[model samples]
Target chain A: MSVTYAAVQWNRQKKLYDSVIAGGVALYLGRFVGVGAMVHPQATAETLLIRGLGTAAFLLLHVVLSIGPLTRLDRRFLPLLYNRRHLGVTMFTLALGHGVFSLVQFHALGDVPPLVSLLTAPARFEQLGLAALTILFLMAATSHDFWLKLLTPPGWKRLHMLVYLAYALLVAHVSLGALQSERNPLFVGVVLTGACVVLGLHVAAWGAGRGYVEVCEVERIGENRAVLLKLGDEKIAVFRHGGKVSAISNVCAHQGGPLSEGKIVDGCVTCPWHGYQYLPETGASPPPFTEKVAVYETKVEGGKVLVSRCAKTSSI
Target chain B: MQWAEGLTTMLGVYGAAGAVFAALFLWKGVAHVDAGARGAGIGFRAVIAAGCVALWPLLAAKWVRR
Candidate 1:
């Protein structure tokens, strides 16, 4: 099983169940109960639509985007990924609601201007929403274990990084959409800040330059293959063969994830994050059109490993 | 078509939120999610299902209710 730990954690089944329950609740509230009588009764169609969209968006963002960090926070969260599709599907569903309600209220059979405005007024901000939505749609459309089996974990994860892009766009989407409406300055600000914080945490992990802990010692490594050197920052494993030792941030570029936890497969080190394969020698990915990570220069001195942190690299 | 458009749209987006959460909770683990301590760490969230039920309406009312 790609989920190496699923058998051990049987706890994942519960999360899966919980997702169903949550969806049921949303349905019950929005449809069964309607959130209409008790609240939003006199709401502008715009308000109901926006509010619904916002709630859905907020839920998906918190659940999906928070995984990488939460994993670091706790390893048990690993099960989250095993069934990540379930979560992604949930997010997409919510986002769909947000979008539809938006269309209905703001543009559903409305006069030309509202329609045009839905497309135009929120263009700048909606552009971000569009970007995030587009990516989310692609991901959701492709989020089957079938595709996961078809595409390598690396490929899957690389595609998933668009989550960051989606997130950035979403922050902009909400910031401007909510802000302009001045719906609730403090509330919008708080949500926006929270969204930024979630996204920033992921960026910070990338900035930390994780994975591939670098240890540079020129003489021993010799050029055949680069062995990893554990650094305070990361546990990098590199290989130098055919005149170039590829270097990626010691962290798995796929998830800003750790690589040390991964295994060596087919002359490449598989990333622990999502089992992405990197040629330690070239830091290049295996197939199709994946991007390569930064390569570093190493000089060996009596077993002392030295690497020039500032090195450039090309993609696959 | 209205129902299709609205229902499809709503399911497609708003319904997605939980699925997304489920993904991260499965993949990312939780804050303070130590392998040895996972049971306790996430159980807290499991319990929050109720809190969330409450929190959701509260948040919806506060922000999106309009």
Candidate 2:
């Protein structure tokens, strides 16, 4: 859905910065405590707790890493902008926790074998947990806005896309390690679903360009709000609004939000992804001058709605 | 040993703090469309917050038991 001015009015860049700072402080302070000597009911319980911490920490990082591409195509995905730093801080703390806890619980006893195990383990080790952590380590170190600003947009995107590597690593790590634990199956399923959804949204968004073009079926979804059918490589719902119902590129340019899934209000379609309102006629974003989206041409033919890939210049 | 306990407790607290921040941010965003791009970010933070919150009591309870 196209973004209207009312939607973008809630800029939270300042709030995002504050959250990041706060999260960093908490993680920083926690780092010392995680490594320090503590009270434990049993050494065994301590070991398990630390291991859990390690796993959870990695999971948090993975979640943070996945947020980028997700926000790119979807305008509503912007809220994460305010809280990304906090997420980063949380991941950092987790990685630190995992590292410290592991060091303390498994290696402190001078158990040289367990200490060496991470390095000496078979190729599978490198392919799994170790690899994931390595990617995360790189990402964490570069996470500061300073690095992001230094790196060009494309550069930042290329470097950060390593998240795919991290994601693959986490999947393997969990499949190989976590699955062995009780209730891990449930957790694994959720993780897998999440990965799929993010990936799926991306594919759908990208498909808007590469997908097959075929008019699936012409149907009236509402009064004077007719939808031109698409069912080829991509699924599009061309909304017919009054004043020459503008043909938006069917897919919510934002996160490929299903325009069909959104509602038509005030002669505009509102995206459910983030409630972006777009005038169906121009596809030009109103109010929120920040975002300008593509506008597609349309024509009503033989009582069937037809949308074009070429942009339309006629304004509403 | 005390460090380890302190670390986990802080990690949980950190998780909760991040969540509260996100929930508040998203609560406002849920009202608009520009907030959509960050939906994953908010949802993920909420999950982290919830996970941390859910496990926090258990971690604290275990400590109390000891």
Candidate 3:
């Protein structure tokens, strides 16, 4: 979408999204710390802060994990997908804060150094927490488009997929660390509910059938709009424009964004995430840009649109 | 315990080297490799510095290749 890459392509919607995130985090942390201090007067400020941040981060992760399936299940959730990275980076920041506070509180001031102490900690939960934090740090660091360019979409996607592993580690970390120590049945119920929601939504979305043999009728696709089809493992975007239909890979060349969510603009399919464009017929960006996506063969039979299982590159 | 100590030492050295590499990369090397970084502002460079520190080895290879 941009000839030059900036730190972030800030827009009105992004600013609003970030503002809401900041306000929500502030409110959550304030309420959590305040209520904890009032209830547990013996708890130190650092302890309350650590608990608040850790809980906030865990809750945010649930929201982040839920956004993908929610968007797939209903297009109305697409707005949440646009600013999901901001939520992720925010979650990582809070987790980092929690980790730093815990390290300083527990590991520091001992004869052993903090890093070594953390690594050699007797508890398996500590090790799991450290591993999860390290993965989160890597993900937050490489969340930029610069890294996305360096690591191609597939590679970048694979790396980000490590978030699921991080989530698993954090779940084990919390279960072993907090659940073992706390007798609160509410904590157990909350963790179980969060995990089940995340898992359940993903299963439901998968069962919603992204892959369809017959996508839909040609008339079902609005002009300049696309209907997403997953044939086998390949996701294809079938676009209708000017009385003709064309199909291309649903994955955007930039950041692996869902191109099916984008609309045709200026005779080119414009990616909804960052507005990256590709010609519908050729699946190639216009001159001066060298991005290309796989074009799929689509046929209209009996007014139904059927996309090919195989992919092919087309001449521009 | 020994592996943990070894890891700590390796990470210390890597962190030291990465800090130095990140400073230089943010100062002069960034513009040479990414055309988009040319004439970019301090905010952009500052934001990228975090990744630069973590990924200094890869960036160093890229810098050398460039």
TM-score of each: 0.51, 0.43, 0.78
The list of candidate 1 runs beyond 4 A from truth reads A1-41, A44-50, A72-76, A111-117, A120-128, A148-159, A207-280, A283-302, A305-316, B1-66
Ranking by TM-score: 3, 1, 2
DockQ of each: 0.03, 0.02, 0.60
Per-residue C-alpha lDDT of model 1 across residues A1-316, encoded as one tens digit per residue: 0332121244668666666748754774475236644565666655665566566666667777777776655458787756666667667767877776676665657544333445455357765675687788767754643334334566767887788788777777877776777676686768867877787766765655443333655455554444665544445555554544444456666766665556557677677677787776567787873756655665444555566544445332
Candidate 2 lDDT tens digits, A52-75: 566556556655655665555565
TM-score of the first chain alone, every candidate: 0.58, 0.49, 0.74
Candidate 2: regions farther than 4 A off: A1-45, A69-74, A82-86, A111-115, A122-127, A149-151, A208-316, B1-66
The Cα local distance difference test for each model comes to 0.57, 0.54, 0.89
**Which number leads on lDDT?**
3
Worst 10 residues of 3 chain B by lDDT: B32-41
Whole-structure CA lDDT of model 3: 0.89
lDDT of 2: 0.54
**Per-residue lDDT of candidate 2, residues B20-56 (tens digit):** 6446533543233233233444333343333323334
DockQ of 3: 0.60
Candidate 3, residue B21: Cα displacement in angstroms equals 0.7
